[model samples]
Target: MKELAGKVKLVIKFFPYRYRDYSRIAAEAAIESWRQGKFAEMHELLIKRSPKLDRDSLISYAKELNLDVEKFTKAIDNQEGAAIIDRDLKLAKELDLYVTPAFYINGIKVLGVRDSDYFKNIIFKELENAKKK
Candidate 1:
């Protein structure tokens, strides 16, 4: 993101795998943290620590980030972020996305991980295509 800077916009959608025990709660915590303006911090903590995304752990993370622990807990407990997750999940299903690290460049779907050049190549091609039109 820092490298791309103003050239690209990042949009993250939640897709918690059904098999993972803490996936749904983690997604809820992340979303609630976003509501409290600490998405990045919570995301980093969750990712770095991982599997420790239980209710207490999430509250501790919120406190660590100086977020409103009460609101955050309520939001997660009530599953207030379910709407957004549901929407993303539906879209993922429609897109037939069964893998993590999927990306779409100018309506072109690319699944799984790839080198930086692979993404840059797609972005450059899209930019060139846009210039033609």
Candidate 2:
């Protein structure tokens, strides 16, 4: 993504699987981190520690990021992230997305895990298409 930093924008939308016991909570933690301007940090940490996304671990990650732990905890407890996540989930459903890590480049939906080269190819193609226009 850094390679296409200036040419493209990345938007992250959360779609926590309802079956995972901690997925929704982790998503809420991410939203709280985003509210504290530490979304990237929290995001990385969550991904790295996905197996341990319990409530305590979530707060620990917030503390590690030096976020306002109390605020984050309160926000998660209050379910502040629910609305935004719900909206994203609704959008995903409307788009017929049933998988994680989906991508849409120029309205071209690409699903499932893809290598960096695959993304680069698509990105370069998009860039070229943009130039032709």
lDDT string, candidate 2, 1-133, tens digits? 6667689877789999999989999999999999899998999999999889999999999999999999999998898999999999999999988899899888888999999899899889999999999
lDDT of each: 0.87, 0.92
Per-residue alpha-carbon lDDT of candidate 1 for residues 25-108, written as tens digits (9 for 90 to 100): 899999998988888888889989887888888889899999999999899999999999999999999988899878877678
For each of the candidates, give the backbone clash count: 0, 0
Q: Could you list the CA RMSD of all candidates, in the order they appear?
A: 2.2, 1.4
* TM-score of candidate 1 relative to the true fold: 0.83
Error of 2 at 16 (Å): 0.7
What's the TM-score of each model vs. the native?
0.83, 0.92
lDDT of 2: 0.92
List candidate 1 segments past 4 Å from native.
127-133
User: What clash pairs does model 1 have?
Assistant: none
